[model samples]
Target: RKGITKVTVEALPAEACRVTFELKRPWRWTPGCHVHAYLPAYSLWSSHPFSIAWAESKPKAQPLEIEMEKIASKNGSLSHSADIDHRPNIVTADSTYSRKSMLGAPTVTTISEVAHRKDGVNIAIPRDSAVTSVSLIMRARTGMTRKLYEKASASKTGTLTTWGAIEGPYGGHDSMTSYGTVILFAGGVGITHCVGFVHHLMLQYQAGTSSTQKILLVWSVPNTEALEWVRVWMDQILRMDGRRDVLRIQLFITKPRHRGEVISNTGSVQMFPGRCNPETILKREMAERIGAMGVTVCGPGPFADGVRGAARSVVTEGVVDFIEEAFTY
Candidate 1:
């Protein structure tokens, strides 16, 4: 059994909640994995599978910026203090910083550049990382999920704590890093399954270990409030190095109350009102695909089926692979 550190009730009207589990020791799993959560307090014999929305290690005393500066100094790549002030903020597995300094700063060196070889094409060393915590987002429907939600809602703190156990970070063996172009389709809580993949791909892309050159995440949510489910994780991803060059996000709000609710943050990440047509989006992406493309979907049955059919319609035009995520209870 593990300790349920915190449970946060999201701002969504659908009664969605995020549960965080603190592991006894470090655990590692690939992207797109899940855990069977057994919350005995809520259900003695019942356990539910939840896709991992985020995972990370416990923070250490030493800051990443100081560590990177030490490494850069060792390699004779450390810049003057004035120049260092203008460098883009670096993000690690457990922390995040601003990326605004990257704009039009030609002389500002990045952590990647400081750690690169003389040839400027290879990373000097592998990143030291581990996972000591796992989090899951669930939309309260029935049974244990509903019970958990109700208890948290009644609490004055708007959070809940209980004993929990998890088994097998399983079924993430499939890899998408080999594809040159990849698109992820998520609906509602399905965003949990795709967020890890995007984070992994971004890390690999920064490390020069992945073949993926382009990534597009197409998510459909009932309202703008649903975006809060992954807002923190997305912020970390957006701050990663080279994120703007390879990643794009398109969000579709199926039931927006007003035009003001649908606002695009930037060119790379845009928001629109109403449902998104899978066929049209798929065809448009296929037209501009760089090389072999991969399409993945994790959503309700009808939404997954629509994405599947759309992918099938374009298989003859290019090398396309389709993956659908589902769980059998």
Candidate 2:
């Protein structure tokens, strides 16, 4: 059994909660992996499968903020780096981080500084820095999920602590590292499945260990508040080395309370209103694909079906492979 360090429930109307566990021993898992969580306090015999959202090791000597600032200052602008030639031509939204003209030197700004200056959210430790803790984002439904959420909600601190056990770092059979271009589709809480892949691919791209040249994450959610589910993990990815050169995120808000609610945070990361058309998004990415492409989707039945259909439509076009995540219980 592991120690459940904390359970953080999101504000009301959003039933999702983040559960963090402290492992007795180090465990390694690839992106797109999951574990069957058994929280005896909530459900004695029942265990629910959840995607591993984030993992970390014990911090080293220096503070994470200090490390982030140092890396940011050293890396400077995203564009105009020495390894720019190795990256594909990705269309980025216009922002203060946009690159200057070829004749002029682009302004230098660290991602860490921009994150703090605009969002007032401090970028925490890197997601891959260590492996002592694992976190999962669970959307409250019936059964154990509901009980955990209810207990945490009733707590004075909006968090609950208990004992839990995790079995089998299962799934994650498909690896996108070999593909030259990868596109991940996530719907609602399914973002948990795709977040780990993005983190893994980014680290591989920086280390020159993988063949991936481009990664596009397309996520569809009900409202802007849904973004909170993966906000902390996303911040760590945003700070990773070569993140801007390799990773592009497109967030589609299916329901919006106001026009002002949907706003793009950076040039590479953008937010849009209305649902995304998988076929259109697939075709657009295929037009600029670097090499062999791999596509994966994790979401509701209808959403996963749409992505599968889109992938099937383009099977005759070029080298493409599709994978869908499903839990049978």
Candidate 3:
């Protein structure tokens, strides 16, 4: 499971990151399914894991993509080098270290080559809001590898030894195939799950086998640039849908450079130039919009809690159904 085959720069949010890989023979995955991503080695045998962010349905094309944020690292110095920003370090038989020592420090050891494989587990990304399928958002730690840590050039994510992991396509509580509407809320990496889930749902809607679920996406990010990664794809999808009146997209920037920059002022979405904790969401009219819609939340705990609390009040009235996918600890 330790091998490096190719590295490429792909699109995502506001950032484009270097995606390195070595797909094993017969590598397989679905469009929304993600695998455990491991960084280069640290010591002789250590690596970190992150989610395989792109759709893996097609086996003929590139298999991975990392949505890189374009911000330069402020921590690339001999003194700041002490930070575990980026370093290729994966766990292997030859690798040796402890949890404490590897916490902030991860070192990379170059190999002649790298190889990777699945332990035999594949997951299906949610394609519909059916009772049988669930939309889950779980998070795990992954080390930043050396490719991300560029002391000379600060465009890449700081290289580290580890990153994050994901759970499964496990089920969630929703009405059914004819839910009629799907609205998703995502902040930061939470957008990861939203992106996959929306792709799945929309595809079903277009096939005529499912209800024409109106899609409303409200994404809370720090800036518009963050949307750059998926901009191209979203544009393509939007053009294909030809149902603008039904699709309402709101991009909420919690840290906009100018004032009054919310994508829309009437919806549950609001733009701010500061933080977007659960408290900020609590202060909004999310409950009203959530009424009669299948509201799904994926973000940190606080944000999820905020969504849950607001929806709980309305759910008792049978206005909407709320499902939260905690993307972080």
Q: Rank the candidates by lDDT, best first.
A: 1, 2, 3
Q: How does candidate 2 fare on TM-score?
A: 0.77
Which lDDT tens digits does candidate 3 get at residues 199-268?
Answer: 5555555566656456666677776555544543344344334334345555657766455333333332
Whole-structure CA lDDT of model 2 = 0.75
Q: Provide the TM-score for each candidate, comma-separated.
A: 0.77, 0.77, 0.55
Candidate 3's C-alpha runs over 4 A off are: 1-34, 41-52, 56-178, 260-292
Q: Write the per-residue lDDT of candidate 2 for residues 160-247, one digit (tens) a residue.
A: 6777778767887776899999999999999988988888887778678889999999999998667767776776677666777889
Q: After superposition, how far is residue 287 of candidate 1 from its true place, in Å?
A: 1.2
Candidates' C-alpha lDDT = 0.76, 0.75, 0.44
TM-score, candidate number 1: 0.77
Per-residue CA lDDT of model 1 for 66-119, tens digit only, reads: 776877778877744635553454643421211223455422211111221222
Q: Candidate 2 — number of clashing residue pairs?
A: 4
